[model samples]
Target: MSAIEALYIFDEHNATILEHVYRGRPPTASVLLPLYLSHPSPQPSLIYLPNTHPPTLVYSIIQDRLLFLSPSSAESEPLLALEFLHRVADALEDFLGSPLLASKIESSYDVVAQLLSEMCDGGLVSNTEPNALRDVVEAPNWVKGLLGGVGLPSSSPSLNPSSQTPFSLPRPSLPRAPSAATANPVPWRRANVRHTSNELYVDIVETLSITLAPSGRPLSALAFGTVAFTAKVSGVPDLILQLNAPGGILNTISLPVFHPCVRLGRWKEKPGELSFVPPDGRFVLAGYEADLLGDDHLASFTSTSSTSKSLASLNLPATPAVSVSLGPTGADFEVRLSISPRFQNKPSASTASSSSRGGLGSRSASAFSATGTTAHPHIEEVKVHIPLPAAVRTIADLRTSRGDAQYAPGDTGIEWRVAAKDVAALLASHHGGSVSASATLRGSVVGEEEEDEETAPSVSLEAGSRWEYDEDEGGGYQTSSSVEPAQQRNGNGKGEAEAEQRSKRRVALNRVLMPSSATVSFSVKGWLASGIKVDALMVDAKRSKGLGAGVTPYKGVKYLTVSRKGVEARC
Candidate 1:
């Protein structure tokens, strides 16, 4: 039997806030708290306490600064106990609002007790869905108080002071039909749901992680994607969403995870097709990972030997190429950034343009506008980070051809920011031009000066060697023969050799100050690096209930790609 013996909640100060027992005699909060705390910080979720009377397995999770712990003496499934704790936390947040504070739980003990009892039956998992729980539980009186203060009618009945009935006398009750909690078929959806506005939104966001070699060859490129869905309708509606990707999603996406409401059978039969009854509010519908450099794409890179062509096949909006050059003086270095030509050209809503938009393929912008979709894709927050060696004391004479560059004396790196407006200006200057736009940043390296040991005074050791002080010259003591050689060396070729040695040392020191890699970060909307796009989102009226006839819901889809220091080029 999967049973949770007891649950204990602790506040940020490790003070016990609430405790409840579900089934069987188990260790109390006092006994379990110290044993659990004995472990080192960043403790694991599950721990075994052999010192207890019956020996218990404790499962714990921390959320919103509150610690939830469950201890079980009986042999049970570890995941069940862990998941139930999470469900309890979520249910409380749904009922009491977010940032589940200790005071909130202390004031709403009645509601919390009911929630715990209903969620677990004799220590076995029962009804944990918030939507279903709302039907069985009554709203706290504080909510009614707030409504009454606002001059709105309260749902609960109020008592009359002039009544003749006795205080203990029971009031007559009327017969009623089965409540929605028992009558509703779905466990996750509440009964009789209604909304004034009918709308559905699908937002797809992908983050890119790419590394390129100094020779402009892609080492690794990956895209992590998430789909967030928000549904606000007047009834329980069924939705079928179709997703399309270039070269088919079956071969492109890997390690995909979907929400519980989604129909897995449909997804397994036809990849990229999602069938589900959505939750009422915003929630993550799915997540996936796609590789930008597949075997076939890498093969193309080998044949053409062009990094831009390979990246273009991935539909990248802006490709950054960083090259570092050492100046002849060896005390200065230059960093150059070349943006892709595609960024300068305006993206069209044509099929050809969509196919080449950044990933494998995506729907055109015109299609979205025709369906009342807003938020066209654009690029913003373009920044480049160049890391310097620790030995460099400072970066002097810092200059940039575009935007701004900042560096601190002891900082290990330099940040270069190019605003979106500046990027637009640069692109406009190169209007209708095939050449890619470029920006350059130059800086001088100032390293800590090393003390020359050769310049120190030297003494010659011999059997009768003596040191003498020069009174007239006011110079320190020195060997009599050593002064003659020192004067001769300065007048001959030795001085030139020493100057050459010092120049070589400066060059080596400057080499240490040069950056080894540069990373680029930016966000692009209306495009995806994986070329995934929504084809359609249709409601199934036959299976839906309470939806009015001729009601057309507003549907919108947005695509966004982000890179947070994920694109790196090694020098």
Candidate 2:
């Protein structure tokens, strides 16, 4: 089996702060650091050091200004070593608080040693889950450390009291609790877990990565989703979750992956049903990939009518529509971005049908105890980035109707950030109606001034037309003899340079200054663009193991949609 030979952690200064050898004689940090530095920055996660005695594979990850490197001499799975490094980082952060500072590790060496030992057994990965580790490994506390300095023991003992901690107060020896691994067959959960207030929470978050063509057609649209569950129930409880999507479960969802605790047989029978005995505390219950583009249209109804196309477009997830227009002088440009809330005041087919029969609660009164209210996803932190051409010297006169916008002199692009609350307020002001918030960025692009000479012919023609009108009216105006010649002479002066400049301007505007594409980043909470809803969560009393009778738990659910540079539209 593939095993970790050694693990090394280096600070930002390329100095080894911690090193642990598991099996083989791997190269030291000094030897690997030079080779790593010789390569270009932002190195790949897996690097092969062929120059070493036995071609070694170095799997590295950077977190909180620290470099974590795992060296394996034998052929190993790349993801296995990388995932192990991630687990170590998470374990340390869980013990020493977030943003695992170097000082925290320096002060709590004893706790670190115990964690490293329990996480890996003889170079093989072992107890890496944080919830399971918390039961076996006790985290050090500063309050107890202060008491120990004065030779006084604290009231309560540390979680992992077996290991000796530096500056820890003296304590009266107490009976140790049995190891959780021995007490329970499932090593992931602790035995006899008790909670005064039993509660279960499910949070479903979907991230959107969509692209819309300039013609308002979807080029590519996808939603990556994850289901995170938290169980604080007293005993091991078996639960089943049901999800509903309008397009049907199998057709809507693809590439589904579940946790080890889940029952694959249950899902195979009922696609949207998830039956599992959840681990204590929080964990990712399931994950899925959905194709938003293909599912947006109805397969049964194929219509060529314009109205059908319009209705279909409305159901798709909202994407920022970007438009660029050049000013009278092609040197100036204006960019407009529009954001429309996707799920505002749009009732689903089920909701509408139920409402017709005396509202939702009355229609579904017998089926569910409480008819839940549907909340639209709240989209926030709308930011759009537009790149400019290299030849453009300056960007000035930036104005946006909403949010703050900035563009420095040397900056190659302009960024516009608008708050989500602002978008909500605008929608609320419209009395629960769908509102579109727009931002306009207008700037002057400076290039070769002689490029304007190409347009002089059009300018002269206008002057001649004006002179003709004045002559026919017999008005006291400048004759065409004087006005037309001056305009024509001006147009003829830089014919060659003007032609070259026009070509350059076309290349600059089409290839450079004009925005070819714009990227948008935003987050939406309490909503799923796919219109997926959690039907219910039930505990199977007959099939469940290790549970007392008549024990009820409080349940809650939440939905979120996030787009981090995931939405792109070509201008």
Candidate 3:
């Protein structure tokens, strides 16, 4: 069966446990009933579980593993409850990062969304109809974007909530000049054209379908006469007719459009050309692909998997601009990037000219108006977003020796997290000793430049690394980033991994828990074998008691170097 089925089995197990715990009396009727049944008292012995609470601890935990949890234990029918839980868990496993059985007591709305989607698709249709899926829309934006006008019948898609990211991968551009046709042609297809409600999206396929002569000379690029694409937008951009062929690709060419607002007379069209007819909406142009199949008559087709560009999503800024925190506070593993560009301090002379032009009588005030300062502030502000989680938090001074060589330092990477008891048990099981520890409030030493950039943090083994940021409650915060052009220059598909970056940042940390007194540190002499360079560093700590973290910033202070020798602050 599916994963959900297995989870249902586990749920049943939980329900059975609850049933036994709740039903304290013996299975025999005498043990259950009251002493005087003729005049039944309020506290009758017949009800198995009239007073006790259902199981409270609903979740289990394992190291770097998934957790299994039941939402409720008040199931009158324990078997039924178990079945429901298992079915829900099985369907939502793709989004959960860990194994479900080991861990328990889970709570999150993202889980609810997944369960709902699965039930709609599964046999739960009778209980939850397809129309019920419309209830998922708590927000108008989500409803409008996802559902549009089409009503879902029943099978609902699981919203991988954390699957919020729609990642893009770069690929080699298709050749402009396509290769010659083969004996049998492969199918040529077009991607779905998505358009807003009022907007029209046309797939201008086959318009430029080209097949060169036997001698490899340009044969003919399919041309279409005037095609009236009744568009919704006024300043519609020049329609881009792009083609990926054997040799090269075509830059965008303009296309004709007529809107309702414009056009004082009859719409003109080129004679002897086919007109487009959309299924329900207005159509514009038509195009299609010519596929030549098999034998190297021209080329071969092969598909390759690809990795995404490093932080490619950075380009698309939110329109109308919502503020963000790249490395917002409270994030243990953080990179605070200040991307908002600085504005011009002085206004331009446009107002000065205006002051001179308006009869010169309004001259004094004209200079101010000519300056034309924007009353509304520009959509420029620091946005700090930390995509990476705290699991990557670096711990310091973890050194190791291979053979006769001296011990060298390296950053510690946790395969996973374990409960304090579990860690102690695992350590005890290995050797003739036992150890105990608690969750920690930790800090790392990072190196920064005068400005945060590609330069990695520097560490001095001699001086103790300490770039401390201690602020009072409700204090301000700091963030930094830099410009490294060397890597951007050779973006020609090379040196991506080894590109020289001035904004290198190295962090060495010794995370000692609040209740601990021992010292912990990790360091490495050089980062050649490993391309790890710490360019920026900051010690971000505050009273982790009340509202949020408070930050203290040193205006002149830049980088922090950390190593086994200890932490050092560099001005």
Most lDDT-accurate candidate: 1
Roughly what TM-score does model 1 have, to 2 decimal places?
Answer: 0.73
Model 1 misplaced regions, further than 4 Å? 1-130, 136-182, 296-304, 319-325, 328-333, 341-376, 432-434, 445-495
CA displacement after TM-score superposition, residue 279 of candidate 2 (Å): 1.5
Model 1, C-alpha of 480: deviation from truth (Å): 6.3
Cα lDDT of candidate 2 equals 0.69
Residues 1-571 of candidate 1: C-alpha lDDT, one tens digit per residue: 7888889999999999999998888887877889999999988999988988788899999999999999988788999999899999998987787889999999999889988988998888898877667656655776657645754333222111224466566655422334545476776766666777788888898999998778767788999999998888777899899998887988778999998889999999988899998877677899999998875755665485676666556655455554443666477777776665455424444322433221223333564432111123566757989899887788889999888999999998999998877777776776455456778888987776532334555443543447888888788876644346657666467668867886787677667667888888888766788888888888899988888998877786778789998888887
Point to the candidate with the largest TM-score.
Answer: 2
Clashing pairs in 1: 314-358, 315-358, 377-525
Candidate 3, RMSD to the unseen true structure: 31.2
What is every candidate's alpha-carbon RMSD to the true fold? 6.9, 9.6, 31.2
Local distance difference test values of all predictions, in order: 0.76, 0.69, 0.24
* lDDT of model number 3: 0.24
Local error of candidate 3 at residue 460 (angstroms): 27
Error of 1 at 200 (Å): 1.1
| lDDT value for model 1 | 0.76
lDDT of 3 by residue, 1-571 (tens): 2211112112322222111111222222222122122334332211233322443212221122332332222334444434444444443342233354323323334444434543534322222211122222122234345445553212122221222235755444321212244111211110122233223332221121222222222223222222223332211112222222232211122233432222223223322122221221233233222222212223211332121211121111110111111122211221111111111112334423332111111113332222222221111121111121233333333221110111112323222122223322333343332111112222322222222433546432322233434376455433332324664355433444433332122211112111111111211111111111112212223311111234221111001111221111110
